[model samples]
Target: MLFKNIVTIAASAAIASAEDVYLTVKSDDSSINGNVLGFPHEGAGLNYFFLGTGSATAFTYDESAKEISYPFAGSYTQFFTVFDNFVAFSVASANTEITFEDNVLALNGSTSNFYACKDTNDPYSYSTRSYELMWYASDAPSGCLPLTLVNSGSAAASSSALPSSTSASSAAPSASTYEGSAVKYAPAGAAALLAGAAAALI
Candidate 1:
């Protein structure tokens, strides 16, 4: 019974500590400005792309750990991961911390590697092709869209001009596809509960 109580407290604390926020981007090109980050479909391992339209994906941002995750996915292992400059969802432990400051998203406190490259085909059929998320060290390939990751709320408040491109009507990925992922964090609440649990054990 004591063990079960401790586990319950720990889980509850984690849930309580998570903050809900949207991952949105902006750029000089109005065509993709104010776009949200999303995946094409529901799958365990899938790459995240940019959607020109539709509601943005709400992610759990653990301010303490500087990690972003989708806790609604039902599995805590799914995290926004980067490999060889490409971004995707994976169960592997995240190696870097992600944070948003001054209305820009930063990785390990730097905001240099994020880029959006156009895909070969339009999968969502919204007439606008989806942009694959990637990280570039120095120069991005020709035609790739440069972007700044920002908090959705901040983006909306600061955005004065609406996208004039026809692609603004592009559909975003369905919410069902956001399942099976989460960000990991060591919440202070959980730590306090653990200390109390230890005292009880003693």
Candidate 2:
């Protein structure tokens, strides 16, 4: 069933605070998907990409099978690949007020991208970019959703795609495809389980 258009929990408190950011990818074609995650590394800054094999932390994707694995979960981008020759999206973590200059709009705003990735392995190349994303949690409207989220600004700087020179000889990821599914940092019942574990340990 199509999910009801409801407010995500991320925007529940403080009304205008910018925290807990989440992203989802939708395209005209049903064969593609993109997944993203934000983790707080020892340092700070937002950096995520499929081409950055240089770092050890960015989420890993099996391009040949079109599968993605997130380390620490929340509302995250999932299963991204070369569905398009290149994919481009922008992230501004200044927590500055959202504005037209940011090219931001409602949740249904325009997200567009076109990429000429000379390297089929990494999509971080400036050449392989298309898509305009404006995270609006900073200035969302009343009744906005409050989902468990992590925005680009809060993302760790260590996140990056594997450098193309490094060959991740995994099965080629499934042909660029998309499957949109909201992930939770923890399942609903896990909270109680955790509390019980804590009590036992204590």
Candidate 3:
């Protein structure tokens, strides 16, 4: 029974390390509609990929309130490997405003990498849009980590097989694949749990 309890405690530590930040989106332009993809590590020479699709539930643009809201799916990640790009979207228009809770971090008038542009070969889409790339910076929260490193041979092998697309329904990498390469961070309560487990054993 003690052995089972110890194993459970270890599993709990792993789960705690995974964190998530919620974002609420809004834009003055009502016509703007589409999906968001983001590469967390800006330094990595990587292409942006779709993160979340546009829909009434996932993305609701309210012209009256000038806001857009997204359903909380483990859609956004605390871990970078869940997807590439911090947050990129192929919305119908260029200007956007992103919020975390009540804090307005990026605004429609403001154009940072948040509005950075890259040429798109998507036969179905056009126009440059704003994206939020979170990294450790003066303005950004310090609780950030660099892009995950994988064996070059492994990343190239994987990338070559998986063609990038702006499909609205793009899914995150499977758990087996991501967890294999994902860098797990210690969650807030992880240390306390580990200490408690050790004490119980003693």
Candidate 4:
């Protein structure tokens, strides 16, 4: 009976801790390299939202639940769409190889790594189409252009934009208007229960 009770208590604690993990992603790469959106063609300006240091974007996920919520601005040209800068991901567990379609992203050490992928069909189709993807570990060929990493805004702000862009060639999006800094795994009542149980043990 004692062993079963201990297991139950341990499981509860694990659940509580796992519910508190979240991620904050802001636009960091804004250079003239392959990493920047629309590279080798027209520069989206220095402070461009997608390529330049424009705004901060954030994503929150619950490891235990596998639930993710992200917000970003959509393209300026597409007035009807919103949240255009959203990216899709496939992650099973922590420390496991996580894969994101189109772009590459991983929590490398302390800094989160991200790679921008160009559209499948290029407008100009330059001789070396490898520069479409930007980042150090980009899957692009060896001769492809390299991306230059830079710092973005300190905090993300909410904009009334949407995620709709299929490729980097589209005009960069505006920041999302939903400003959520953190994520919660459990409800307010769950925290209360955990606190009460911890106090009883004390």
TM-score of 4: 0.30
Q: After superposition, how far is residue 113 of candidate 2 from its true place, in Å?
A: 3.6
* lDDT at 182, model 4: 11
Each candidate structure's TM-score, on Cα atoms with residue i matched to residue i, is 0.63, 0.23, 0.27, 0.30
Cα lDDT of all candidates, in order?
0.54, 0.24, 0.27, 0.28
RMSD of each: 12.4, 17.7, 17.8, 16.7
Best by lDDT: 1
Number of the predicted model whose TM-score against the real structure is largest: 1
Cα deviation of 61 in candidate 2 (Å)? 25
Per-residue CA lDDT of model 3 for 93-118, tens digit only, reads 32344332233333332222232222
| lDDT tens readout by residue for model 4, 108-134 | 321232444444243333222232333
- Candidate order, lDDT descending: 1, 4, 3, 2
Name the lDDT of candidate 3: 0.27
Residue 15, candidate 4: how far off, in angstroms? 2.0
After superposition, the stretches of candidate 3 with alpha carbons farther than 4 Å from their true spots are 1-3, 16-24, 31-35, 38-47, 50-113, 116-202
Candidate 3, residue 127: Cα displacement in angstroms equals 6.7
